[model samples]
Target: MSALAIILVGLLLCLAGALSVRLAVLAAGFGVAWTLAVAFDADTGTTLLISLGGAVLAFVLTLLTARLLFFVGGLCVGAVIGAKLFVLVQGGGADLLLLLVMVPAVALTSGLLARRFERPFLVWATAFGGAALVLSGVGRLWADAAGELWRPGTTAGVVVVIVVWVVLAAVGYSVQRRRRD
Candidate 1:
């Protein structure tokens, strides 16, 4: 398959995986709804309508599968990664590797953390997002240390990510502590 086909398939599976997580339903919903905006394979109106329909279905499915959300999330993440693997084998692109590795890894780790620390999925999600931001910033720094290390955008992103994660972690700890009350 072509690279565009591969990316499209990957994105679809990612939408499915994201929809599997109740907490991520909003993002997934919007993402699916924006399909037309990104893909030009069909009439804009028709594509947008289909996207909206899919978003509604995904949102309902996510809510109904809330109890099994993590397992579903893992499955979806795995599927997306698998799709990426297929793309890579087809000589898709270097970015496929990042998606394959990051998606499943983040899903597994986040699922585990959320399970171990229930009632704080929001904080955990925030921390995970922050960690990702920090990692991305670090990668940029590695790529061009001289240009971005002290750049306002880079510094701000890194600092916000770290501070957010730290604050979330502290909040998680506090919530756990107070639960004994």
Candidate 2:
């Protein structure tokens, strides 16, 4: 992966893990900003500018219209879930039909979940999203180091990654819940 991709992934993991609950509005803002930056294929400098702009926009919009912030957060969370699902199902294949179907479905499901259960949804979504990003970054780094795609010599490596991801996500969730209480 490029340095930009690594940086973006690291920022996402940090936002989701540390700031999602304590500073939910800020996290949501940054999440939306990062998503837009990536979607637009902004260069590093442009991406930074867009991210900062989005953060300010999110903060202002959040204060002016909290519901809108929630909706935006839901949309960002849904998009992340959709992207992850697409990666898993695509598997080096290009199927427009599958993409069309799966993307909307996952996004809608996640969005609805977020709308229905705002606090819990944010907590879990952020944690899982962070974990997913961390795992993805690690996988990409491993691939770069090994000069190949991520095919572990044994299942142990994959298992370890999954375990670590789950543990990290659980820790994030617990920390957020405790803070909330």
Candidate 3:
């Protein structure tokens, strides 16, 4: 049920994120709330209820301070990219210190760019984020049904996931680009 909900939300973000920034912001809040709630070992119902409350608070705050939130989102996206680059470059000896130093620099740059190019950046951000959610939700559903992990189990699973993410993001980006005013 949760997996299904995730897929639906992911699709909404992917296909219509740029058309509705408010919804996208709400979804981001909800997604973050859900992730944080799940990290605690609590009753599922109670956790979900609390998560929903948190999401609501986040949505309201984001609505009040949209520009600040977009800058934060840019920082997050840049930090992720920077960390990934660090890992890939360092490989077996990925240094935490270097990553810590690198992430902030990249994040700062990205935040500035996001502020300058809000709509286009949001379109890209939503596309990438949504694609990730769709893939993760599908993988979770598949694992639950089959009692196995698909991405890690397959020999080329990682590559396939990356390829799929890129394709899905591209499709979403293209569609949203056309649709956005």
RMSD of each: 12.4, 9.2, 9.9
Predicted candidate 1 versus true structure: per-residue lDDT over 1-181, tens digit per residue: 3434533433332222222244356567767667755676767777777777767878788667655665444444334333323332333244756666766775676556444553355333433333333333443445464223222244454455445435543553444345435
Give TM-scores for every candidate, taking all chains together and pairing residue i with residue i. 0.34, 0.59, 0.55
For candidate 1, give the lDDT: 0.46
Q: Please give the lDDT score at residue 142 for candidate 1.
A: 54
User: Per the 3 Å backbone cut-off, how many clashing residue pairs does candidate 3 have?
Assistant: 0
Q: Report, for every candidate in turn, its global Cα lDDT versus the true structure.
A: 0.46, 0.63, 0.70
Instruction: Show pairs that collide, candidate 3.
Output: none
Off by more than 4 A, model 1: 1-50, 71-113, 116-119, 143-181
Q: Which stretches of candidate 3 lie over 4 Å from their true place?
A: 23-66, 75-112, 144-150, 153-155
Best by lDDT: 3
Q: Rank the models by lDDT, top first.
A: 3, 2, 1
Give the candidates in order of TM-score, highest first: 2, 3, 1
